[model samples]
Structures are given as C-alpha cells and as structure tokens.
Target chain A: MSEQIVSDSVSAIKCTNCAAPLNILGGGRVSTVTCEYCHSVLDLNDNYAVLSKFEKVKRPLGPFKIGMRGNIKGVEWTIIGWVTYKTIEFSDEEWNEFFLYSPTHGYAWLVYEDGKISLSMKVRDFDLFSWKVKKPKTLFYKKGHYILDDESYMFYIDYVEGELNWVAKFGDKFTCWDYNGVGYRSLSIEKNINELEVFHTTKLNKKDIYSAFNLEYSSKSKTRKDETFSDDDESPSVFNINKIFFIMPLLLLILAFSSLFYSKTVYDTSYRTNQKENFSIDSSAFLTSIKISVSGVGTANNKLSLYKGDEKIFYIDKQKVFFIKKDIGKSWVSNAIAVTIYLKLDKGRYHFIGEKNPNQSITTVKIEQQVIRTNYLIYALILFVFLLSIPYFKERE
Target chain B: MTDGFTVEKSINCPQCGDTLPLYFKHVKLVQCLSCKSTIFLENEATRLAGDSSVLAPEISLIHLNVPFGYEHKSYLPLGKIRYSYGRGFWEEWWLKDSEGNEYWLSIDEGDFVLEQKVDSRYSRELFNTLNVGQVTFDNLIVTETGMATCEGFEGALPKTVTKGDTYLYTHLSGKDASLTTLELGKDGVETYLGKWISPFDIKKVG
Candidate 1:
C-alpha cells in the first residue's frame, strides 16, 4: 500500500525489520540508522562488523582447517589457515583471525598466527550467588571452532575489542559462552566443551542465508482486484436490451401459432353392411368411405364407435373403410314394410346408387354420426388461459 | 427427450401474476420466490402426486430420505437402489451374516463398502448432554443367547457398549427379513416408537 524509493539504484536496501526500502544515507557511506517500527538502533558503520562469540573452549590435538567467507567491515576476505587453541595457550597472540566474503559481517573466524583472537560474550546471573550484589558469568559464546584433533574442537568469536579466539579441551564441561550481539544475546554450553558448536559450514544451505539476514523472498502476494470478474472499459451492449424486448414478443407469437393455427387433418372411408342394404358401387372403387368410417383423433383411447338407427351396428374403429351393407329380410315384408331396401345412413353422408324414391327423397335426412378429433384451438386456448391465469392464481396454490 | 413436450406456460407469482424462473439444485425444498411457500418434493413423490406437483408452476420440492443404519453395513437402504432407463429403479432388502453380526440391509449393485465410526452409548449420552448430533454406535449384539418370543428378549448383552447410543433392528418373519424403520417421536406423547413395514407381499410368521 505504501511505496518509497530511498536509494539511487533501481533496487534498494529493504529493512529486515520493517520491509521499508532504505535510502543511501550520509553520502553513500554505511551509517547507523534507527528502524522506525522497532526502534532498534541498527549499526551500519564500515569500520567493524559485529560478530557473535561462543566461549566453551577445546583445542584441536592436531592442525585443522575451518572454512570461512564474507566481507569484514565492507572489505572482502577469504578463509585462511586456522589457529588451534592448543597452540594459543603457550603463545601471546590471544586473538586468531581468518578471512572470507560476507559483505555485511565480513569473514566468519578472525584467526592470527601464534594463537587465535576471538570475542567471548558472558551472561552474569545475580540470583545464583550469595551476598548477591554483582552477577557471575553463567554462559560464554564463541563464533568459530578451533580444531584440536579430528574429534576435538572449540568455537569462539569476537563482537567487542575486535578479536576472535578458540581453546580446545577434550572432556571438560563448560557453561560460559558469548553471543554475536547482532542476532542472539548470549550462548552457553552444558556437557563437554567440544559439543558446544551450533553453526557449522557443512550444515549451511540457501535458507540459512535468508534466516541469518532476516529477509524473506519466497512469500506470495494476493490482491482484492483479482477476486472478482472484470468489466470492459467501454460499454458496447447497453442497447441490446431493446433487441431482447423485440425477440420475446416474436417467441410468444410463434408459440401461439404452433399451438393454435397448425392443423393436420386425415380423412378416410369406413363401412357397415347387413344383407338388407345391398348397396353395391361400380366395382366398389372409392378413395375413402367417410359415411361408414369413424375418426379417432384425440380421444382417450383414440377410437370412434359407429351405430345404426335404433339398432346396434358394428364398430368402425379405424378412420378409413370401404362400404357398409344392411340386410332386407322377410321380416320387413311381414311387417308390411317394402322388401326393396335402401341404406338409411347417419348424417346423410352416404352416397346412393339408385334414386331415392324420387317422391320420398325430396326432403332432407339426418343421420347419427360420431367423429373423434383433437381441436388444437382448444389446446392452445387452454395453454393461453393457464399462462394468463398464473398471475391471478400464483399465490393460491 | 420428447419432441412435442414443451414448457407450455411459465409459472407466475400468485399475487402479481408475473412469470417466475424455476431452478433446483438438490431437490430438498421448493420455495416460491414471490410468496416463500415451500413444497417438499419427496412428499409429493411418496404421495403419488409427482405428476401434479411437476405441473404446478411453482418450484416442486423433494424431501430426501436420509440413509439410516450403519454406513458400512451392506444392507443400508440407500445402497440397494438400482435404476434402469425404461424400468425406473427398485430395491431389494437382503439379509447377510457378517462375522457374528446379522443384518437385513439394502445396497446398490456396484457401490464400494464404506467405513464408518461406531461410538458407544455412554458417548452418545454425553454427546446428547452437550447437544451434539453426530453420535454413532459401535457395539453390536450377537445372537449367542437362546431365541425368545418377544421383541425385547433377555439375553447376553453386547459386552462393549455405552449408555445412550442407537442401533438398527432387523426382524425376520418366515422367509422374509427386513430392517425396521423405527420412529423416535410420538404422534400424540413423550416417545412413541413406530415401524414402517414393506408394502410388498409379506410372509406370515407366528
């Protein structure tokens, strides 16, 4: 949320404490500056870099080499041969120094000939001693290890007085230690003096550099803008609402036409015959028989029933037929009815071959006919009514 | 999949008569957006009014029957359902003996066995006291004791058991075996236990 550019270079020094970019201050010379967040007085001088010292002493039995690298007080350096504390006890050179390339803290161990120069930080506990007015040293810390043998060593470093030291004792138990005042405050030991070494060059990894410098680089960052869908800067479809409005009415019209106006009608002939109705056509050739046939379009079973005048007749289940004949028997003659029989049809839909007694056929005749068909207009009406009435009955159901 | 079948009319709000869009995810409940009237779809299906419920313009809700009994048991009712395209779906209740445990359960054809936690009755009582709903039962009763004439028979109780846990009961009548659906509440009191027998032809047993 906040940005600052304190350095002249494109990349700037970032604070390990506050994440704030540090500006090149005091004409590009490293100088002490206070972190605004933690109020820690950070020493940035190029003269002497702070080193943590541990002080449990053990000397190497034989000559050994300890690795070191870094810059000392802004000056580059490399590892030199180590000085053993076994040699330092009989020598006057109390400080041992070495060289490496740590730009901020210089080399690890400062080893010199004749002995080792090192700083040992001690912790004083006032409560443990009687007459307890002053504190006695409880822990001693050193930075680099001095090898007395392949199995024996002691670590030490200098934070003040600019020195480094190591003395090796094989089985002696020591409790006093020093701290590289830069990170931790103090270091102490509990069992053998040779076991007090905590940091070793062999155990170093990429993460160790980040941890030592207190700077993190592998963290992921997220923003609120990435969470939601993005809208284009220019709005192009504002007028599309009108087009949708026009399309809705057209859809409704099409639906209405499909249900109401569409009609697929099929017509055919059907026949019913008894002996009396000797109605024979010229070879009985016809496209369809409508008079005798019944149509079933939309009924529950899709069937139609056919009947005769006052008498039950055959059922014509299908839509098409040929002809229907009824018998003229002696019973009609005995009942004083003429034997010459003619077809008595329902709804006058049947065709006749002979002239109906020209005198008797002068008037109209009504026949019984049943036709089954599905009225699409009725279906459409029902759909329309249901849609229209939903608004009124929405809450009722 | 039918050609002529179409949504002829849109359901409208009862009061305003405005068309309302309907969509369902789980089919647990259907609520009218306008009037907030909720319908249980499962109830409709069980009542044989599925067609009528679907015809209604409002949302058709479904009430899911929770799978009862042990989740790991093969006879759990939810597992036995089998579905087909033209034949719909049906379930068969079967009985099996697992080690010493006997059960009448339902299971689908191809489902894998599931592992579930079985708690004790004392834990159930404690969980109930704490108002926790997820108490399970682990103790299984074996039929080492002699058979009895009543539903609750005196016998050797399950050794590992707690105070207030629930367990499923399987009843065997003649050739048929079925899991009893026990209702915990009363229709009219403090506690009333009811059982749902299968609707199909059942064998007679003394």
Candidate 2:
C-alpha cells in the first residue's frame, strides 16, 4: 500500500517494535505515540524511539476507538489517545481514559468503568491555591457540597495507545483523591509530588453518549442494570402524593355543597288532634311525588290512619303503657312512648285520622310532608379521611 | 498578518554556531536544536549558558518552530516554565503572534488555557484580600483553584521568572466555556483574560 502523507516532511512512521506504520495526528504537540500493533510506546521527539513495550491485555471491545471522530455538545472531538489505568492497591478495579481532543475546546477525558461512563474536564477559574491552604475537607461548586469519597494511591498505567499531547509512559503513578456530591457531580484531585490538579466530572447516560456519537446501541452490550452511583430502588417522589391528599377533599366538599342546589322542600305541614278527628286534602298540584313525616306522643291507646279519600293507604296502632306497681318495694312505675313515620306519596289528596281511648288522657298526633334528605357531606367527610390515611401508611413502609 | 500564517526568520545560534529558525519576531529567547543551548535575542545577541532555570521542552510538549492558531490568530511557541504546588506540576508556554502580541498558554493534564497578561495594579490588592471559595473580581465571581510553588524551570522565558517562586491563581467562568485567570506571582499580580480552547481548534501551520 502507498504511504499516507501526514505533512510535507513527515509521512506515517513505522513503529520500531512491530514495523507497523503509525501516524502522529497531533503533529508537533504530540511527544508520545503508541503503536496499536505491538502496544509499544514510541517517542516522537527521538525519531519514534521504542520508549516502552507491554504485553497486550485482553478485554471486551468498547464502543469508542482511537482516532474515531465524533461531536460532543456541538464540538467536534477526536479520540487521540487512550490509557488503561488500574489501582495499585486494588488490582480488581480498573478504568479506561479516552483522551478526546478538539481544537476549540482543547482536551477532555471520557472515563469508563464498571459499565458506566463519565465525562471529565479540567475546571478553569478555580482558586486551587487558596483552597489548598485552607485545607478544606469539602469542596463547594455549582450549588453542591462535595465530600471526600475516596483517596487512593495513583493508578498505574497498564496500557497506552494512540497519539498523546502529553508525555505519558507505562507504569506512571501518582496519588489521587476523589470527592462526590449529590447526583453525578464529582471532583478528582491528582497529586504528583507538590503539584495538585483538580478535575470535575459528570456522569453521562449511555443513550446520550450513543446519540452524541451517532452509534447503534443495543442492550446486549449493557452488563449492569443499575448505575454505579444511582439509587435505583429508592422510593419515588412523595410531593405529588401529598398534594393529592390536600386537593381531593376540597373537591369532594364542593360536590357535596353543589347537591344542595338540586334539593327543595316539596311540602311542610303538621297536624295535632286531642279527640277522634279526621283531616283531608285535595289532589296535589305539584307534578313530583310528595313525602310526609308523622310524629306523635300520647298517654292513651291511639290509632293513626292515612287514606286517599277513605281508601286506607296505611295505619299504625300504639298501645298505651300501663303504670301498675305491686308494693314489693318503694318505687315509682311509669312508661313513656313516642313514634315517628315517613312515607312517600303520589300526587293525590291524603287524610289523617287519630282515635283516642275513652279516658281523661288525650292522644296527640303530628305529621309532615317534608321529605328526609340524605346528608352527603357526612359521607364525603368519611371518604376524605380514608383517602388521606393511604399516604401515611405508604410512607411508613 | 494573514490568519493561520507563520513568518519565519533564520538566525545563527549564538552559543553553538548552528543555524536556527526564529518563528516569531517578538521572541526573546530561543533554544538551539543541536546543543540545546538557550540564546537571548536583543540589539546585541547574547548566549544564556548554564541557564538551568529554563523549562524542559518535553514537559510542556512545546515545539518552537511549529505555529498553532488560537482565536483566528496564529502564534508560535517560544518558551515554557514548569511550576509545582502541593503535589502537582503544570507548565506555562509563552506564545507570540505574528504581530508581536504576547500570550500565555497553560497546560495541566489534558487541559489548555490561553491567556493574555493584563494590568497587575488591582490584582495585587485582590491577592492580599481574596481567600478560597468564591469572590467577586471586576464584577465577575470566580473561584480560587489553588496556589502553587514553582518547582523548577527548563526552557527560555519572556521575563525574569525564578524557580521555587510561589503564586496564587484564581479562575472566573463565563458563558459558552470562557474562562479568566488571576495569577499572583512574586512580581506583583497579573490578570489574564482568555478562554479554554480545544486542541482541535488549534491548527498547525507550516
């Protein structure tokens, strides 16, 4: 194959270890270039000298690759370098740093670990010098207070590939400290001797990363169902449920009040009798049915009858209570009785007759045409209390 | 000066007798490729020997002969300084445009910050009073990132900067990823105005 031209004086240079042709795309800015074929670290400053070599570590293929170009947040970035770093003390934990480069945005890092990805960038305008002197245990940024989450020795570089703007070699180590706040925001402090560098990172969703790169994403590659830092099993927001408890009762109360507008008193009257007396009324003028209530209290045997012009519709007999006492002990004996009745009558005249016993005690009879209405407010209040208790029980669990 | 164009001037290395190319006219110091000797440029060119205070070229990944564009203007790297504070180290590269305008490019890890020195009169007072966290400077609230003690020096520089020097740096963020830095060094205080630029935004020119 023909050689690929990188510049006027430089074409793709062959790797010293594997003789594989490698291109230094960062031009003069890149001092270190890694050969993909043999995993050899090549020194661009010294005519691509073999600075270091490492045995290739096998792993699953990630979605990103060196030299792949994609747009992130409207800026075009190219994956110029990648490094696999593992903790010195914790060998089981490891992460990959994909060095992204954009001429306008400079450099950014995409960190992938445990099937999760986060984008980290150097924060500018931070007052690190004063913060170091204060020796603050926490860092405040973007309305969040970040506390120290983890502190570990610098990660050892296990593998390196592609062109790097900075000089990086295998086995490079430094001390690192991490701070985490609410959600995905994190602050990482890397200390190399007396120098300290701080980086801010935010977790990115897989779908957003896929969309940004315009790549086809499938669930087959997703190994974990939960996020590294997210609390997926936590209860949902309780604000909506609390608000429902307040608004529902008010609505029920309004419905109960509105029912009052449709109710009317069709008839209201009462009758009282001392002796055998009968009363009658003509056919009703109203179209709807009429309702009547009868209440009476007496000391004699009373018989009350309701009829439509002598045709008895209903009748009730009340027996008088006898006040008889045997002198077994000094005690007073008496009995009191009262009765009430309700009836729904059609549009017709009605008669009420009251008969009293032949004694000095008189029987009194009372009747009414008013219908008994149901108290809906009482029913609504009971239902409202039940609905309000539901959330209280849910919160307890 | 045309955008993305670099004008080169050739001169003999005063220390080594080897011919060297000066990429920018305003560059005060140049390092010899053959002998790695630093040469100072002025009315009478003089060689700065035993100037171990110069930053290492590999530390900053800076190449003097290469031209890079920033903010639609092309600049050439001249020299760099290595600084350390606490347990980290960073490098600042001195750059000059074709028109002799000077700027500073700070590189820490993969981050690049481009800045221009401003009046240091007010910055001295800010350095004396300002603490960590957030403070308002020039009507903008900026956070104090850290302070560092200059660990050592390597390459040629524009001004007299010594190793072991300490300075306080603060940053103010702006809309659309713009940033400003306030540097309080041994030589009073200096305010730098610039934004973070991506490596892709900088194009190499021959």
Candidate 3:
C-alpha cells in the first residue's frame, strides 16, 4: 500500500477520550493544542495524546492578590485575587507556573515584564474579528467563562509586567506557562447544575468549527449523558451550597414524618404457655396467617376445645398437640379459649393419645404473632400510593 | 471362613506372563502379549461325591394347584362366562384348602363378591342354620314362570317330598313374576304363587 501524504507539522490533536483527531487552534507551531472531543489541552509531543499534561495544574498557587474590572462579552465581571498554579515540568528542572483570575476564561493576560508591551493579555474570551488563527471563527466571553467556537474554559487571569509572559486557562485543561513563575490560573463559575457539558466535538462536521460548550441542561437529560461526569464540579460556589442547604431540611422532615406514621408495636401474653393455662387473643390485629400450638408431655393427649362464648367452636378428642392455623381474619374468633395442661411441663405429654412426640420441651400454647397487622400495611400502602400520586397529580393539574 | 462366592483370578500368559482379564458376554478368547497367541477361557467341574451321586440331581418341578370343581355355580354358567363382555356382572372362583370341616362358598354380582371361612364348629353351625340359601333383599321381583321373591330363611335339612308337595315361591301374590326371579327358581324346585299372601306355606303329600 502506498503511504498517504499528510502534513508533518499541523497543530492537530486527537481526542484522548474519543480519539477523534482535531486540527488545533493555530494549526501551526504552537506550544498547546486543544482537543475537540473533551476540550482537553494537548501539548506538542510525539504522543498524539499529549493533552494528558494539561491536567497537572489542579492545585492553584497558594496566596496572591488580584484586582481587575472588565466587561466580558457584555457581562460585567470583577476579577479579584491571584492563584499561582504548578504545572508538570516537561523538560525543565523547575515547575511551570500560570496566573489565574475570576471571570473571563481561556484568554489570560501573559505576565511579561521586559518587553515594550510588557503585560500582554491573550484575551481569547471575546469573539475576535480576525481569521489569523487557523480553525478559529468565533470566541465568546462572559463572566469567568469563554467559548472559542465551541470549546469553553473558565480560569483566573494573573497578568504581570516585564520579564515574565505567561497565561493559563484552567477549567478542564487550558493551562500554559511562558514566564518564571509569574502567572497562574484558578477555578471560576463552578455551578451546581443538573447537566453541563464542558465540550463535545468528537466529530467535526465542518473544518472551521472545532468544539461546542454546554452550560446546563434539564435535571433529567443531564443524568442521561455519561452519568459519571455529571455534577463533577461542585466547588464552593454561592449557588450550589445554597441548594444543598435548602433541600436538606425538606428531606429530613419527610423522613421524620414517615417514621412516626409507620411505628409498629407487638403485644404478647406473658402468662399463657403450653402449660396449664388459657390463651386469649383479639382477632383483628394480624395481617397474615396465625397458628395456635400446644406441645410437650404435660399437655399430651390434652383435650383442646375452642369456645365462642358458650358454643364449642372446635374440639380435638385426645390432642397430645394442637394447632389451630388460619389466616389472620379467617379464624373463628380471636377471643376464643385456648387451654394447656401444665406449668411445669414434661416431655411425655406429646406422646398422649398416640400423638407424635414434641420436638420442643415446653408444653406451650403458642399464640403465634402473625405478620404485621393488615390494616397497618394497608394504611402504609395507601399512604405510599398517595405519596407517589403527588407528582402525577401535580403534573396533571 | 464360611465358603461363599469369590472373585476369580486371571492367569498370566505363559509367553510374557501378562495377566489376562476375564471375558463373559462376548466370545471368550485369551491373547498372549509376547508371543501373540490366543486361547479360550474355560472352567472345569469338580467332583465332591461318587459318580452315581454326582450324576445331576433330579430337577424338581413345582406344579400350581388348580382345583377343579363347580366353583361358581351360584354366580355363572361355565360356558356363559365368555359372553359376559366384562360388563361387571362378574364372578371369579377361589379354591381354598382350609382346616378340616369349614366351607364358605360365595358368588358375587356386580361390584361385590364375598367368601367366608371360619373354624369348623362355626362353619357347622352356619351351614346347619343356612341349609336353605339366604335371599338378599336387593333386586327382588315377581316373574311369570315362578312367583319369585327374596325371602331370607335359615338353612335347614332338605325336606323329603313325594309327588304332591306344594310350596309357594314368592311372597308377592298380587303381582306377576319377573324374569330374574323366575330364573333364580329355575335352579331349584319351586312353585310360583299367583297372589300376594300373608303367609307362604309348604305341604307334602305322598
């Protein structure tokens, strides 16, 4: 196969995530290239995936002061405080640094001290009228946010004069340095949003356009797209913490009320056992089937007669053991009588009247506590139905 | 140790002394490993007694005891059984060799067949009191040929009768005899009565 001829030096990079090769901003000799897929930064290197280096500027420079007031894309924003950031050293012994600011991203003022235009600010935040940069059509700038065609970056700007000339944009990898620790970048405008895509330019339908930026989608659609990446940048912003504090109390109140309405208590007879005693129960409480048991040698062949007041409801001739099992509401009456043989039980009672021996020693009249009362489960189920119906009712109205 | 069946051992080939396993289902042939020779596996009988005594013991044959008698005379005709078509009007014979002096004969109709055998004294007492057959209350009717009726009676000795002996066959003298009731009297001496009577009497005259 004949080798296809392509340019040896073009500022083109492939998305590290999607591997879609994108022509860089200048497409010329530039120190940096931005990926179209993830809008990640790519440095010029043999590894086509050089964008991995830009993630090195995570922690900002410790403490510095910055003050600037400007109109970014017609939105007025105040830039205050400086953030010096450390970058992964490509070849030098010293770490690379970039300046950071509040509003207006991507276009940071390069801190240059010696040259005639000592403080050179590369403000790619606004839509530039010139076609000087390859693949550049438009660049938009708002408060701490910039959009170049589609790629959006939010970072701080730290511009200095003379010997140093450096700039960095730091939301998701737009960091660069050309000075001696004179400029840095910091986080800005991290929103507590349902959906926000930083960049999505996996496929280039057109050559001039490189990337796209998404600020926020609805709460539902945000989770649909790569559920892992959503809600990632929840920095200490004014909007996000206020939202958490607002919803936290309402959730706690609902949980507390649900616990109160669902309280359950069980009542059991202490004196009643398979020994010589009678057990009485109220029929309505149980939700599932109930079983009455008599075991042990003491009550072996003991006559079990259930009475509804004076009428004999059920009788066992020589019941060594007895079990009156029925669904909770199906029993004749829970108020019926249950008799046992002894307090001091014997193992021999189960053998009376040709009955199988009891597996347990206690000659107990087991008035088994059935499952939770049906009324309670029903009420809970109704409340649940009502609770679930609220959203539908609101939607319908 | 007491003698019983034992697992047999195989003899090694004479040429190579390799052990040969026993073969039973297929043709028995032994193959030698070293010289590649084949031989048949066999067993010889051993004698533990004299020639006359060892000449195979007489093979005893067991015969099933099939009793030949009027087994179901009360229930079916011998040749008529095949025509029954298994419609459940059926009876089967059972020959029982009981202890001496007891006999209980039963014939079934429909789903019920019964036969009772007891000790001799009880059998004698039953037979004496049941000389005449007991008539069931079921399916009794009056027939044309004989006034047939099911009248339960104690078994007794046969009464001697000459030419002029009168006996009523049915208790119903007001209705005609049914065919089944007449068929019952066909097996014995009987006289059909034409009218319902309060008392059925028998008179014998020489």
Q: Is the docking of candidate 2 incorrect, acceptable, medium or high quality?
A: incorrect
Ranking of all candidate structures by their TM-score, best first: 2, 3, 1
Report the C-alpha displacement of residue A389, candidate 1, in angstroms: 2.8
Q: Which parts of model 3 are misplaced by more than 4 Å?
A: A1-291, A294-364, A367-397, B1-206
Cα error, candidate 2, residue B114 (Å):
6.4
Compute DockQ for each candidate against the true complex.
0.01, 0.08, 0.00
Q: After superposition, how far is residue A280 of candidate 2 from its true place, in Å?
A: 71
Candidate No. with top lDDT: 2
Per-residue lDDT of candidate 2, residues A1-397 (tens digit): 1112223222477998889987655534567888888888888777778887767645334667766666675666667788888888888677888887655456788887766777888765455555656657777764455677644466777778887766666777867877765445678878664346778886777667766666666665554533433422211123334455677777767756654564344334443443333443332322222232233534435555566676767655543211122112321122434454434555556655655544434444554332333355567677777866753554343
Over B1-206, each residue of candidate 2 has an lDDT whose tens digit, in order, gives: 23443545667877678877555655566667677775777764655645534443442334554677656677877766777743235678888777778889987654678889876546467666665445464545454467877755434456655456677887765533456787777667677888665553566665
Per-residue lDDT tens digits of candidate 1, residues B11-93? 44344444433221123223344443333334223111121111112110111112222323222111111212121111222
Model 1 Cα lDDT, one tens digit per residue, A208-286? 3323223242322111331232222111121232343445555555655553333221222222222122222222111
TM-score attained by model 3: 0.15
Q: How much lDDT does each candidate structure score? A: 0.25, 0.61, 0.26
True contacts kept of each: 0.00, 0.13, 0.00
Candidate 3 local lDDT, A224-302, one digit each (tens): 2225443322322223333544455455456455544543322222222333333333333323122334433433433
State the DockQ, from 0 to 1, for candidate 1: 0.01
